[model samples]
Target chain A: MARVIRTIGWTLIVLGVVVLLYVVYLLWFTGFETQREQRDLADEWSLTVPDDPIDHDREVDREAPEEDDEPVDVGDAYAALWFERDGEPIVSDDVIYVVEGVDLPTLRRGPGHYPESDRPGGEGNFAIAGHRTTYGAPFWSLDVLEPGDTIHVIDRQGREWVYAYVEQRIVQPTELWVVGEDPLGSGAPMITLTTCHPRYSDAQRLIAWGELLDDPIESTAEGGERDEIPES
Target chain B: MADNDAPNGDDPGPRADPDGGGRGGIPRWVKAILLLVVIAVAVVVLFTTVFPWVEERTQDPTMGTMLTPWLAYLRF
Candidate 1:
């Protein structure tokens, strides 16, 4: 009986070690791997998103990327987001990339724009999602946004849509009512950003909402301060 | 006139080696049963716990598409 108990104890210890190792892989090593993968995505998006222009302003009557317009791939980066807090593209700051389609592959690149929703600066809800803790964790600092903070969404043509942060909420993943709405009733374009809450768990979801300002500012390739072409 | 057939004749049908199952000497049936149990546990743990935890932590962005349904099923 003593030998049996001792053997069982040893087996438990071994199993415990294996679980610990797997947890480490999930938390740390996966981030490094994802960052490497995101680098490739960023490089490819730099070349593609620019040449393809998407118009969100009704005044312009420009072509927008919808299912009917073109079949945007799931992982295609449609826009780039910059925080006004960052201010003037300094070192250690990167424009968070927003790709088309909210899925594992698309979000692995950065933030993912939910398909079947309005584009940035459009007439309706432009909902997006990202990872808070892993897969490059683009929205890791999302909690830091305060009401009235400015979020810049620049498009492939270097046109910038400025949105003012309104409010944030935490809800279950099933509480997806915040996703789609008629901005016409609200009389402005809206944005919704989502991620898992509590930093390390997915039991809940964190959501940030914003409203796009009218008369969005446009940055020309020649006028923009940055050397690289903008792809919002 | 007889084929030295162990199946027909009296050959204590494949007697266990005096030294037990194999090099480990624990008995082959015991090892096989143990392996099967481990695999079943691994499958349940992988879908119900490990994968969900990984998806939560890393967001499993690209593959997360497929895992969404599995996560939903295992939520309960």
Candidate 2:
């Protein structure tokens, strides 16, 4: 009886160790191969076969004009809102814009700060954080954004990427599930905008979800692109 | 006639019972095998279904920014 018990115990221990090692491998290595492949693809696509590259900085400095009614470009039209101690625009070249009417504070982040684990120029969700009621009330109207509203994000290239509103919900603060990668399942990409609820209380979080509705419009392509653009 | 006076005291009763057979307990080896099978199934399910779903949800922003290029890549 003692011999039988000892053999069984030893076998179980070995099996458990093997199972654990396999799980670790899946989480840390093999599971991440897809992302690496995607990154490689991106790098390959970004390679430019220069047609007629010129000094962009020198050209801009030479062409500066005074008393212009319209923006110099579409990129300039999408401005980042910065707060002041006494109500003034905080001007900086690094600031990025949030979706119009997203209740600014919820999406507000410090200039040039991006999360390390996330992709810098991805299409699915580009979430920014800001205060709900205070700090200039950026996201005050966040709860009021209905379906079909357009949220625009302008990248450094002066291209505008538009995302259309889909849904919104209020959930408990501890429900980290909302922030998790698999809110629904794989292949269903979405954006989740979140803020503290009830204006000033941290009781709950309000989330507004949206989906990319159109491809990004490069600054040079806007004039001709409008005709081919679909209603998103 | 003499042997039938009383039954032998050493005779055993039925070996198997509906609720409590003496040998019905699962051996430790069987239990270990079962545990291994359950764990393997769980890991397979998580990797194939659960993990991908979670990755999609949490990586949305990253995915969204890259979606255009990714879609174009797929076309080729």
lDDT string, candidate 2, B28-67, tens digits:
4665677677667766776677755543332222112223
lDDT of 1 by residue, B1-76 (tens): 2122345556744443653453445765785578668756865786588776666544532212333655655632
Residue pairs in steric clash, candidate 1? A79-A232, A80-A232, A104-B61, A104-B62, A105-B61, A105-B62, A154-A232
TM-score of chain A of each: 0.75, 0.43
Expressed as tens digits, the lDDT of each residue in A1-232 for candidate 2 is 6545765676677656755775455345432442343334234323421221211111212122322212222111122222111121122222224322222121222111123112212433445443454323345456655443544443333233354556666765555555455353433445555565655543456666655544422222111221221111
**Model 1 ranges off by over 4 Å:** A1-10, A51-69, A86-92, A156-158, A183-185, A215-232, B1-49, B52-76
Task: Considering the two chains of model 2, state its CAPRI-style docking category.
Answer: incorrect
lDDT of 1 by residue, A41-129 (tens): 66766686654333334243234544323456787767777665423331116767777888665666678888878877677888888
TM-score (2 decimals) of chain A in model 1 = 0.75
